[model samples]
Target: MNHLRLFLLSIVVLTSANMLPAGDWPHWRGPNDLGAAEPGQSPPAEFSDTQNVLWKTPVPGRGHSSPTIIGDKVFLTTADVAAQTQSVLCFDRQTGKPVWSTIVNTGGLPREIHSHNTHATPTVACDAQQLFVVFNNHESAQLAALDLNGKILWKKQGPFSPEQYKFGYGPSPLLYDDLVIVAAEYEKGYIVALNKKNGDVAWKIDRPQISFSSPVVANIAGRDQMLISGLGKVCSFDPKSGKQLWAVDGPAIATCGTLVWQGDTVFASGGYPEKETMAVKADGSGKVLWRQGVRCYEQSLVAADGYVYAVSDDGIGYCWNAETGEEMWKKRLGGSVSSSPTLVGDLIYLFNERGKCFVFKTNPEKFELVAENQLGDEAYASPSFCDGKMFMRTADSTDGTRRETLYCIGE
Candidate 1:
């Protein structure tokens, strides 16, 4: 009888572990970049700077990169303007306390950046043991790998120093298997994959023009390929060999964020010459099944069920049919927005530049606004969802004071 009771207890433990909801937003656009979470879960209907926020932790310096959560820890990067320092910060997910900060002082290089840009504009990606961060200083573009406890494992610097736009490096790193891939589409356009363990060059492919978009991994037609978008084009490359598989040209402007893949279809959106959104068949041959011009800049598209949800840089939200490229609904909101929309169950969350967040229903037939909340600051960085909590960061103030902070919104 005792043995049977113990066996039953063990079974219950295993089942509970497997049944727990997957809420960890480990990367830029959450797990796998689909931006859709498991159904039946929803964030709080109303949250503000003072209410319903689980914790608000102060982050050093200013950066536009979003926060990535792994296990019980959250990781982000920032740049100290006057100090000319780039640092990666770790926070305790549960208590919102600072864990450790690893500063990389790349001296004299940040002077070349635009006044609005910073040394840290890219978010860090981490697996179990290592975190990958990208820093674009004035003279050097670098990617570094650090341990969870804040030890630098390896660092790699780029050869070319190109003039960045008003914003610095907005391309975040993507991690695959044992490699950290970087889209260094600057003066010398190259997509380089480094061995994640030791920072050795695994594969590098050169392109014609530099872009600000990050690379996305997709399994198309029974093979894995990295889909990257840049100035006037989108292409897929063999992830292992860095060989181009297919290319489609004519994107109006520079790509800003990562592409989202759904089934065999991928959605990409950006703004420079206005907003252009398209859905390409990920057949491993880079075929365009259907393309529609939905104007959005700097905002990544999120697909859920049968619809694609997007927010324009100017703060307009739209829902469209993912299959037919038909517009469903469009609504104007409070302020300008750049963070991607996140779908948690049937609710879609959108955050704007002035730190206002709007929640709406995910129904494809209509636009149902639910709640609008504010954080009392500016938010240029994207919001991340993990462990039933939403993490967001505010931009810095104009007085060179770091008013940026990380907020964990949850029950």
Candidate 2:
């Protein structure tokens, strides 16, 4: 089916369950990439490396990607550095026991990546029946579909060369309807949608140089548009035909975070010193409502209750009024932050690179730090919250010492 038809069909499927209670963190940045959890709930405020952890599973290899939890299963990807193997690991959500591990076919090539980058930066997405994963092996990139039981259903490899960045490919794939959207922006900047059932090309559009940011799907002006940021530009496109609808230039920093949207306004930010954050009106014509500069990177924005919250890569957290682009307040967080901030009710949870997480109030007038905890390692992967628990992953240190601990933080 074409993308338009698939989108229409998905609307039907989604509406029937719209009223049903939903709480699965099935992909990056949670459901719909909004970063808002269920209201009136929070992660445990006082958990150390060993305390308040319901379970800790040692994942194999190394990866900075976050975990995606559905129903009773949790899915993530990791790279075997010495063996040159890329695989997906599935674990039981309740017990943290290994269910299965599927080795992905990376073709015949030596895996080339930055020392800090891995082959598993993209988080997997899934529906009720199947799971999807993206593997970039330097020479080529491939997207694979597998059954819930680990059987490979289909695989599609790209004919274009892999794009080289200071880091590796960090853009995760987004699934909309029956198509899987993957951003190949390095050697050749393009956004292509593949048939989810058979891995066929549904639509492809060539784009300019963009950074390692993922694309988001949203309803703009009664039409469905894919929002993407990179190459000093934030643009929207028709998902079915890849037609550019509108765009606005941004800062020079490589865009590495998800865009946050509330009603008709979309917010994006990146860069150091003076990071640029803008609230653009996505009303089919793409107008800038307001723009502000803030220093943030690699961290996605979270919107809730008319406020947008973000933590800078240098460890500063700020809350902004969503409608008017007014700064509420800013707080100086002491650790470096790479993961995004997730809002649960009136509280904001921020996980930092130094293995510390800070809990603060999501107030619009001032800053309030409620609690702080440490993990005793480096954390690059964002936390996944589901069923009143937060899942966190950390990077291994130098000297070949691997630490693939998955901590389940709860009360």
Candidate 3:
């Protein structure tokens, strides 16, 4: 079905009991946004080089961005380091066949970035009518809207050039209402929203200081508020008007994970010069309830049933009391973690840097490890769960030639 017809149709007819309709992961943190997929999907938690693999397709180039699944098409952005090009790839959702690739930027790829960061690190966000992506090319942030057939409809440059830091961009495009928002958080940073139809600028705000976090819009404290951490604070913005709702200090000056919430309180954690995880009241009160010295950094937090769950960089899974900042449980999972956790009903799927996935339950009482699935030698992209299957971007090196593959896990 086309996006217009899907929008006109009743959501009751489209959505499942507790998930977005169509089981499409439209953006960075999936459809419902808090890194969770549609419940009741029992995609195999165990898979290897051969076991339980539905279809395996080779992906060109490299990126840390996760897969964005919409309809029968899966979308991702990749950059050829040698060619200095950034492009988007489309794959047939069922057969794992390459549909089309559109290069958004050629040449002028930033020279210096963290070894783990990429020119095409941001995940594409698609609406009913267009696909939106951002790339840090030409030493600035470029936003583009593409059609489903891999055609660039419009590309515009936003104000972003980190003279001091130069870490590259990490925030994925956030689709809210009719706007596709993008954040580039250097000292002369900006959070801008553009019209999804024609790529017209809607609203823009300046942010000082540098950070790598993504902007997330959630309905918390009884209303819709946009949350992003960094620039030395946990900040909230009105997604509609580009107004600052509130900001609280601490959670460090640099972060990568998007903000997650439980009830009226939202949790944020980060890495940089310091480490801290904080719970802030989201009712425009600028009140911070609790904080812990532990950090999640690149991995975002998932909270449910009055508890927040996170995996540390040193390979440990932890659950904390959501309201009281009490440590509930911690289990060492081994290896470093970078991928954010995705929750499917009671189960949360977490991937470490070594491409080992730890399947565990979302219980606050104790650490519950369900299964451990290993796929490749390295992985930084989080898995996208959709339609009873998993779209994972993994890589294995053979004789120093690293090959990336997009694997459809489970039957």
Candidate 4:
């Protein structure tokens, strides 16, 4: 009987391996939503425009949205400013050639956005069957589901004007089971969970304050909770019912990074209005473990090996003890970072606005630099890894050109 049990377990493991393979950045922050790469996939530690790069494809228009890879296809969103159109694009994962392009929305403006924000700023998400995209066109917002072949499955829109915020909208959709959840928080912001199969609204809630932070789902103890941080509150909701679970005071007037979870504790940081970081209990207790002045505005926090790592917007890197909130180490990485770090094995890959990719070891004892490489232009989006390749979206040109390009880097 024991021999038979082992045999069945081996079959299940083998079958699952063949189905998912070693790499697939199906979510904006990798499959696990923690920005960690799959095990045993050692992407190149250093690469430039002419180094280890497998392919470089030119993407039309401009956007800071990160690339999402699933199976053999890579998905991204972009906006053609002159034409007044926002689009969802899919490309062949291996060859970097355009597979298909579909426009999600066209024309609809009267709102001025931040110089750094774009209409196509949100990253796309994909489940097993369809790809999801979100866009806010000044007066309203729309969420659409597309088939793997680029056909629209269903699209839904709601009233959302970001003119009051001045920075525009930049949050992405979260795919939770059969629901595509989105948080559109500006003046009079709200959260919506849509039926993934038919684009129907499953649940909705109003947010008291405005923020740009994306929502994240974390399983604590034994229950799954959806966490949304911004509007000066750290709130958890029922992903299935859209019911509010609990709320705590978050320090930021505007936040762009999602909460990072470790054990039963969750960590959040705010950059605008205030530079603060807080670790709170996730059991709806509203208990604060520790709060500090360390601010990581744009980049998200990464927790590993009992330490939470962060790189501030202006280049200050930090490693804090996740439990005690004690500072482990800090160093200036030397460039502005709007992109979050991706953890692969023992190393963390951090991209700066100047196109420099900084690789370092994730250690609590000290700061150690591994390697630094350039993409030959500006890179505002985070890096995505699949199999053995690193996909990065960079500015069209280093000389201030307006186009955007997605580059695939590997051995």
Name the runs in model 1 displaced over 4 angstroms.
1-23, 38-40, 112-117, 164-166, 284-286, 395-402
Candidate 4, 268-329: lDDT as tens digits:
99867888999999988899988889778877988877789999888989998998999989
lDDT of each: 0.74, 0.76, 0.85, 0.83
Ranking by TM-score: 3, 4, 2, 1
Candidate 2 regions with alpha-carbon error over 4 angstroms: 1-21, 106-112, 159-166, 251-253, 272-274, 395-400
Q: Per-residue alpha-carbon lDDT of model 1 for 1-411, expressed as tens digits?
A: 134433432342233211222545556665645665533445586998778899999888878878888778889898777777889999999988999999865465544554434567787787757788988764556889999899998888875456545345678888877788988776666888999888899998885455678787766666787887767776788888888887775454577767776667877876566457887877755567556676666767877766788887778888888888888998888687777787776688888877788988877888899998887567777778765677888754667764888998889
TM-score of each candidate structure, all chains considered together: 0.89, 0.90, 0.94, 0.93
RMSD values for the candidates in order, in angstroms, are: 6.3, 5.4, 4.5, 4.5
Winner on lDDT (2 vs 3): 3
Candidate that scores best on TM-score: 3
lDDT of 2 by residue, 301-393 (tens): 887667788887789888888888888888789878878888665667788887888888867778888889887568888888877788888
- Scored against the true structure, residue 151 in model 3 reaches a CA lDDT of 88
Model 4 lDDT, residue 283, Cα: 88
Deviation (Å) of 84 in candidate 3: 1.5
Q: How does candidate 3 fare on TM-score?
A: 0.94
After aligning candidate 1 to the native by TM-score, how far in Å is the CA of 117 from where it should be? 4.3
